[model samples]
Target: MLIGAVVLVLGSLFLVVPFLLGNTGVTGFVIGFIASLIPLTVVLLTVRLIDRWEPEPKRLLWFAFTWGAAVSIAGTLLIQPLFALAAPTSSEEAFTYFMATVQAPIVEEFTKSLGLLVLILAARKYFDGPVDGVVFAFTIAAGFAFTENILYFGREIASSNDPGTDLVRIFILRGVMSPFAHAVFTGTTGLIMGFAARKWHSGYAVLAFFIGLLPAMFLHNRWNSMGQNFLVEYFVVQVPIFLVAAVGIILLRVAEGKLTRQRLLEYARAGWFTPAEVEMLATSRGRRQAIRWASSRGRGRAMKSFIKGATALAFTRQRILSGRDVHVHQHDELELLRKIPTLRAAVLQ
Candidate 1:
């Protein structure tokens, strides 16, 4: 019951960001939706291409987005109101300083990072490694940014009565310059959370938490600072950085995708995969071919199910080998595994 409540709370938080953005205006709403959705869809499809073996649960993905929206909204609302009162900005410079340097960096990063905390607390096992922490953090941060963009765009359209430069500027800033701004910000939190989840050291965990938060806050500050110089500002500063980050991100995913291959290799050395099954998940090329083999032979669904079941087998095997009983429903697990051969036979038919 408590777990269910937590999930519900997290989902509602994420749902609100898009809602807020849409309410901004038709033009801003449309532009913001297009800007964020296209990039995110590509990312998702790319993730599918790579991690074909064990897909993260769809429910968790939804929860991440929802968690970001809700937590961000609540955090900004709670914090910013106080900040505004504290700053007492009567001039543009003061207001700008208060907002860009102070309010935006702190509020956005913290709220966006809350999802990492939730992920750490709830499902530590699913986090494959450090890179996953970064990816998940980026996801929540982007979700928050997407919603924030909606609101900002809606206002731009409402005031100007057109989808103008302000909207484009936002695209450049949120979509371009700081593509990984929020990711970097919340990524720190994720690193800490990931480490903490794996280890049970409260003192070290607290230290990790602060260490992570510092870099995130600093990055947000620098990104916002870059915007202060209006004319000189361009993707020149960001493009190279983003490219480097992109390479790192790709390598991380590629490494993660090789988990099955690693597992297969471990036992392939001992003859678990019959050389054929081992070859299937060994490389990106091999994984694709395996999927295609399954799909072309008109066994797409069964292939997907088989691959998924096989992954479950792997993870269960891990737990069993570790002598863990947390998930020791062996009868149920075997029953599920037994269905795979039946499904495969149907595919063969």
Candidate 2:
């Protein structure tokens, strides 16, 4: 908690200093910040949906966001200039193109992915599977997009001759059309790291990070390289990619639900939970019905807590099976086991 507070404070400074330095006036900054939240909210809601099965720790989620919005963005800003210094004294247009297509994708994805690595190394117990990976990745991407949108919106508002017209145009383009671009790009890395977390040791998980960067960098490069024919490329290439990603996420969510049921069945065999309780805790419809039943008895919150604890128990079982860090997960397993019966009693009462 103390570390999270320190990161939040430092991240806030890193984010604010850039806008201040850019002379994005107070009006522009405020308007930009407000406009940015519209899409940020949408992105976060989508992430919440993906993460519904078993939520990651809130502190880690916040860390992912801050890393993207502040640390990753700051790293990109600092490194890209050094690349500029090394590049040949070429035409301005060519340099801009190179930076956009090459430098930004490489630098941005690397920095964004570093957040995932940090979580895997520092908080391995929570970083369980691919869905968790996508959740964290999407969160970090959301934060980055939020910050980037503010800068784009504020600069457009401040610099454009027709702020109203340009604001509408840019908002439609960035806010409505391509808000998930960053998430899609960085999610590749997160997905890979997540698989690594489940199957491999920490050292191999580090290797997985670089392997995942391949697709992330490629997708980012493709998106930025679309120049004059933005509409054509967007429809032909980007739309299909986004559709594929969405479908993949849906499939992963279903898999997560199934996995939760399967894991809890083991507990049922051990008498920690009944088979009926596993069914109630694992399925969407079952959970909803359980909640409604609990609410009718004025135990809605207790039911919710019971469901959450049971879900955590299932995932802790998963971590144990994976053999990544058995000793640590064993402790969590015992603790959850101890807590679950108390939570269940509250729901029954």
Candidate 3:
């Protein structure tokens, strides 16, 4: 079922691309789609590395990404045309301004943010932490961006009767610099969604999520408005805003990385993992490095089994840390998972 959903959503997004645009050369359209897709691929790899606790199925990941693209593309297509109706009689400036200032932000934010609600309501187990929330939201946003690039790129190609310039701009703006734009916009909702999931309160989730989304939309729209005036916007606004957003995202990831280590440390001290094992889980990079080091020595599968076992051990330790005795509440499943690390240690000798 999950696989079906992923395929269905992805297929639908592919169909939507050509329908939305009036004109586009096949080469430029393909370039635009591929250009937008590369970032989406890189970020998913990052998500997989970070989310060891309950890594979502690859199928579900695709479903989320595809859903974002399909829905957001449809939304902008349906609404933006209306704004074109409201286009100013005097100049193209009015049409561009209206789309930038009024239509795009509201539609795009809502469309991308639908993923938070979907994940929270439908797939409860996958909702682990802020990173998961961000990953989900970003995938959805990427999906939207992918379809959007196709439409806008396709139109530009058709209008100019030459796809060359359109391809270059798409590569720079949508492909390179702006992948973060949709992700950041929907992230405010993710922050709220994560809090709500942790609390297990539905009404609270909706309230908090939208509260975050509304502000995000405003910021997104503001950035778009300023940014359309490139010369003035770059020096006066865009660069500074980019720097701030970039720094903020870095801080959040750093804090998340720190907490992950701290949690493992606490678990290790409680005997959920050995002091040596906890050291490995402290950073995913370290864990991978250690695993590669082990595999080179011919213990590859055993090492992965060891990490999986360690994870179960870590979960048991977490339960213990949460409970009265720090030991009594842990059950049989945890015991079962702990054996892999034990086996790995035995092999190490």
Where does candidate 2 have its weakest 10-residue lDDT segment? 12-21
What is the C-alpha lDDT profile of model 3 across 315-345, one tens digit per residue?
A: 4444355442344435634565457557667
lDDT of 2: 0.88
Instruction: Put down candidate 2 lDDT per residue, 1-349, tens digits, no spaces.
Output: 4576466549666655665448566677888889999999999999988876578878889888888888788778778888787666679888888888989999999989988998888887788789989999999999888888888888887889999899889999999999899999999999999888888687868998999999999999999999899999999999999999999998988888898899999989988888899999999889999999999999999999999899888888888888867998899999999999899999987
Displacement of the residue 241 alpha carbon in candidate 2, Å: 1.1
lDDT of each: 0.62, 0.88, 0.65
Candidate 3 yields a Cα-based lDDT of 0.65
Q: Which is superior by lDDT, 1 or 2? A: 2
Off by over 4 Å in 3: 1-15, 25-28, 45-54, 79-92, 227-232, 239-250, 257-272, 284-289, 300-305, 308-339, 342-349
Between candidates 1 and 2, the TM-score winner: 2
Worst 10 residues of 1 by lDDT: 317-326
Stretches > 4 Å off in candidate 2 = 1-16, 19-23
Top-TM-score candidate index: 2
TM-score of 2: 0.94
- Measured by lDDT, the strongest candidate is 2
